[model samples]
Target: MKDLNKQFSLILLYALLFQGLYAVEIEFNADKTLLDSKKEILELEGNVSLKYQALIFEADKIFFDKKNDMFSGNELKFSSLDNFFYGAANIVEFSKTKLTLKEVEFSTCPCEEKIWWIESDEVSFNNEEKIVSSINSKIVVQGNTLAYLRKANFPISSERKSGILLPEIAINERSGLDIKVPVYINLRENLDLTIEPRIMTQRGYGLTNELRYLGKNHNGFFNSSFLQDDKESFQVLETDNLRWSFNFLHQQRLNKSTFFETNTSSTSDPFYLTDLGGFMSGLSRTLYLPQQASLSYFKKDFSMRLDLNSFKLTNPLAVNQFQRLPGLKLNYFFNKNNFKLVLNSDIAYFNKGGSFRNNEKESLSRVLFNPKASYLYNQKNYFLESSISLLYQFKNHQGNKNTELSPLFELNNSLKFFKLSKTTKIILEPYINVAFSDQKKIINKLKIDSGLRFNPFKHKQQFGSLFLSNQKDIMIGTKLTHTDKANNHFKFEIAKLSTLGQKILFIEEKRIDLPEPFSLKLKYKTNNGIIFKSHLSLDSKNNFNLTSNSISLNFNKYKILIGHYFARNIEIYNLNNNSLEQKKINSFEFSASVHLAKNWSGGFKFINDLEQKKNVNSVLSIDYENKGMVVGLAYMKSLELDWVSILENDTFKDYHKDRFRLFFELKGLGSIGKPKESYLKRRNL
Candidate 1:
C-alpha cells in the first residue's frame, strides 16, 4: 500500500513539471548557494532555509518543480514556534481543507513527547475547521502513556458561549475517593456543572448537580446546588434519603460607599406537599430547597440597600418567609453637623395549607415600621438619635374589619465610653423612648412596648450593656464573643422573643463568620481541640425545651445532636407540630455508611411511602482520576422509578419499579447540543 501511494504521488509530481526559467540562489554564508533556472522552482541542499506565507521553513534536502509549482522534501521539518509546527520523515501535502503529512509529528511545542501524531498512511489537519482527521490513525494524548485509536475527528478548544452543554465524564480523586468518570458541563467562565454520577460495588446510586455564579460588579456572590438520593453517600450524614444544598452571596461596589450582603441556604425537607401546585412545578422530587437572593444600590451623600430572603418548603405541612426592615430602608443625608433620616420596615409570613375561612389564621403575616433620625455632635463620639413607629402588627384570621392607627415615639442620646476608659476601647449609649397605641378600633385591647436602656459597651470588644427599657414593657438582650489564641472562640447570647415575650439563652463555638443563632442549639468544632456548646430555647408556650443539644467526643471525632427547628424561628416552608399530630404518618426512612481505610468509601439508605414519597430522586456522588485513567460509578433512582410521582403539581400513587431502583450514571466524553465557541473568537457588539 505504501509503495502504491508513493508511485501515485511521483506520477502526479512528474505530470506538472515545467521548463526552467530564471535562476535564484539559496545562500550558505560560506560562499555556497543553490542556482536554479526556473520562475517558481527553487531547491536547496544541506541545511536549506526558505520563507513562505509569513512563516519560515527548513529541510535536510529539498526539491522544487517549476511547471508543477510544488515543494517536496525527504526527512523535512517546519516550525512556527507556538502556533503550529510539523515534521515528517516522508512527504507533506497542503490544500484548502487539508494538510496531510506522512510519518509526521505535529505540536505547538518544539519538543517530540508533547507532539500529537498518528501512525497512519495519512494525517490531515484542518485549522479553519478545527478538525483533525486521520485514516487508520493511532492517537496519543498526554504522551504515549495513554492511547486510543480510530478514524477520529475532534474539535480543539472552546472558549466562549454560556448556558449548558450535555455533560462529559470527569475523573477526579480529590474527594477522598477514587473517581473514574464524572459527568460535567462548563456553565460559564467561573462556574461548572457536575453530576453526581456515583456507582460502586457496595452501594446503589444517586444524582447531584451544582449551580455556581460569581460577580464583583455590584458586590454580590451567589453559589448554590440541589442534590437528592436514597443511598447513603456522605461520611458525616446517615439517612435513606439525602438532601444537600449550598449557598453563597457577597457584594461590594469598589468605587461607591455602599455595601451590603446577605446569604441563607440549608438542606432539609420539613414539608409534605398536599397542594396541586407542588406536583406541577416538579418541586417534590427535591428533598431540600434552599433560596438565596440579595439587592444593593449605592450613590454618594446618601446610600441605602437591602438583603431579603427565606428558604422553606411551601406546601401542606409548612410555610415561612421573612423580610428585614433594612429589608426596606430609606435614607436622607445633610451637611456637616447634620442629621440623617432613615425609615426601615420588617415583615414575616408563615402558613400551612388546608380548609380555611376566607382569611384563616393559617396564613400569617407580621410587620414593623420605624422612622429614625440621627445627629452627629463633635463628629466622632457624641451623637443624638430619635425614632418612632407608625404601625406594628401580626394579622391572620384574628384581624379587624377596620384597620387602626398605631403611633409610637422615642428620643435618644448616647456617648462613646471606651474612649475615656484606660482600656483599648469603649462605648456608652443611653436612649429613652415612649410608645403608646390605641387599637380599640379593631382589637379588644391596645398594648405598647416602649422602654429606656442605659447601654454601655466596648465596640472594640470586652464590655456588656445594660438595657433599662421596661419604661413600657422592658426588653433586654446581650451577646459576647471572642476568638482567643489556639484558634478557639466562645460565643453566647440571650435575647427576648418579644411575641409570647420571653428571653432565650444560647451558647456555641463561634466558627465561620458571625455565628448561627441558637434556634436549633446545635454546636460543632474542629478535631484539633475539644469544645462543646449548648443552646436551650423556650417556646411561646413558656415550656423550656431543648432547641439544640449536641456534644462532641474525642475532639470532634464523634458527635451527637438532637433538635428540630429552623434557625431564628424562621417562618419559611417547614412542618408544624399541629399538622403532624393531626395527619396519620405514612413514610419511613433508614440509612448507614462507613468510610474505611485505603480510601474505601461506602454507604446505604432506603425510603418508602408511595403516596407521600417522591417517585423519582437522585443520589449524590463523585468520581476519582489518576494520571490519564479514570474510574467512576454513579447511582440515581431513575425518574421512571418513582413511587410517588407528581404530575402537574398533583401527587398520586403511581409506582414504577423502573423509576424506583435508581438511575445509573455513566462516565465518559461526548457532549450533546453543539460545541462551544471560543471567547476571543466570538463576536459580540
Candidate 2:
C-alpha cells in the first residue's frame, strides 16, 4: 500500500512539470525539496539539478513555478556540450523554446583564470532560433576591460550575420595610435560587405570599404580606401592632402573550356606602397601596380589565351610600361609513334603612354608563327632527342614594317653511368646539347615574348641575354647524384656554353663584349636531417672573378645562409678609347634562424656592403607562442633608394630610420601590432 502511494506521487510530479505541451522527459533531483500542491510550486535547496533535453541546470537554491515552467534561483549554472553560462540571478525563465537568465557572468573558456569573459545584466537564449542576446555587456580580457556594448546579439550558427566585430588597435612609428572599427553587412547568402573606419593620431582618419560576392559561376571582391591626411603628416610628406587606393579581383567560368580572370590595383601617391603597404599586403615592395585581364580556353590538343595588361608606375625608378591592347596566343600539340609536333602563334599590339621619360610615345604590332617537330629515342642508360623549329615574325614599329624568319635545330644526348654497391649507389649523367639559330631581322627589336624554339635543351645561361642572339652553340653539362642506404642524397651539376662565333650582348641595340662564365650548383641532404646547398660562378677569362655565389645550411630547427654577387661594370665609348672599370662586388648577405627554447625562436639577417664597408640592412626578431597567445618583438634598419632622377638625374641611398615593433595576440581575438617580414620568414609562415 505504501509503494502504490509513492508511485502516485511521482505521477503527480510529472504532470505538474510540463505545461501546455506533451510531457517530454524531465529529471529532477534535490537534497531538500518542498511541494506546495495548492499553488503548483516546488522549492529546492542544497545542490539542485534539473535536466531537460541536452541542457542541464545546477544551482544551490532554486524555486520552480510548475504551472509556467519557470525557475528562479541564486548561484545558477547552465551548460551543454558547446555552451555554458554561470551567474547569480534572481530569475531564469525556461520553456520549450527559450531560456532566459538575468544578470549573468558568462565565459567560453574553461580554464581556472578565465583569460577572457563577458558580463551582462541580462542574457537570453532562444533555443528554437539558436541565438543569444545580451543587454549591457562588458568584455574583459585578463581582468582588463576591453569593450562595452549596450546590446549585442550573436547567432550560434556558423553563417555570418549582422553583428559587431571586435575592434582592432595597433601602434607603430609610421601610423601612431591606430584604431579601427568594422561593421559587417550580409546583403545576401552569397554576398557580404564590410565598412571599416580608422583613426590614426599621427596620420588622419580613413575609411575602407570591402565588397565580396560569390555565385555559382563567378566570384570577386573589391576594396577601396580613402584617407584624409593630417596636417602634420602632410607637412612631412610635402605632397598629397588626400590619399586613396583601390583593389579589384574576379574570376568567372563561362563553360567547361573557357574562363576569365581580372586583377586591378591602384593608389594615388607614389609613397603609398612604401608607407602603408605593410598593413595592406605581403607584396609591400611592389613598384608598379598592374591591371590585367585574361580569357583562356583549353581542350585536349589545343589551347588559347587573350590577355590585356596595363600598369601604373608608382615609383620614380620604374619605367613606362607597354599596354597590350589585346594579346592573343594559340598553341596546338600532336604526338604519334615517337614523333611530337607543336604549332604556336602569337599576335599582339603594344601601346605606350603616361608620363614617360623624354616625352616619347611609340606603338608596335607584331605577329609570330612557330612550328616545331621532335623525335625521341629512349633506352635504359642513354636517351637521344632531336628537334627542329621554324619561326616567322612580322613587326610594324611606328609604321616601319619588317619581317624576320629564323630556323633552329637542336640535338641532345643524355648518357648515365652508374656504380652500385651493397650500401651506396652513384650515378653520373653527362648531357650534350648542340643547336643553331639564324635569327636575322627581328633581333634588334624589343619584343613581347620570346617565341617558341628548339626544345629538349633549354638550360639557363649564367649571363643571360636581354635580346635573343643568333648563334651556333654547344653546351656540355654533367650531373652526379649519390644516394646511400640510409636514404641520404647528394647532387652536383656543372655546365658551360661554347659559341661558334663571337657572342654579342645588346643593351637596346648597343653591342657589348661577353666573356664566358662557368656555373656550378650542388645540394646535399644527410640522413640525420642536415641540408646543404650552394651555387657558384666564375669568369675565368676575366681574372677568375667570382661572378655569383650562394650557400645555405640547415640542421634541425636552425638555418644559415650566405650570398654574394659581383658586377663587372664594363665601359663603352662612342668610337673612342676602351677603358677598364673597376670590378665592384655587391653586398654580402648573412641570415640565420635558431630555436632558442621550447617555445621561443629568434632570427637575424644582415647585409654588409663590400664597397662602403658598412651594414646595409639588418634585422633581428624574437617570438614566443604559447597557450593561445603569441608575442613578438622585432627591430629593423635598412637602406632604401630614393630616386630624384625625374627632376635631377641622380639617385641617393638613405637608411631608413630605425624602428621596432611589439606584437601581442590572443587566439580568436585581435592582435596589437604588425609582425614584420623577418618574423614571418623565420617561421616560414
The lDDT leader among the candidates is 2
lDDT of each: 0.36, 0.68
RMSD of each: 14.8, 6.6
Residue 232 in model 2: lDDT: 72
The 10-residue segment with the lowest total lDDT in model 1 = 461-470
Per-residue lDDT over 99-197 for candidate 2, one digit per residue giving the tens place of the 0 to 100 score: 777877765444445676678888888765556788999988778887897998865444577655655665557777778778888888899999888
The total number of steric clashes, by the backbone 3 Å criterion, in model 1 comes to 63
| Model 1: lDDT to the true structure | 0.36
Candidate 1 local lDDT, 132-158, one digit each (tens): 466665544445623444565533333
Lowest lDDT 10-mer window, candidate 2?
642-651
| TM per candidate | 0.41, 0.79
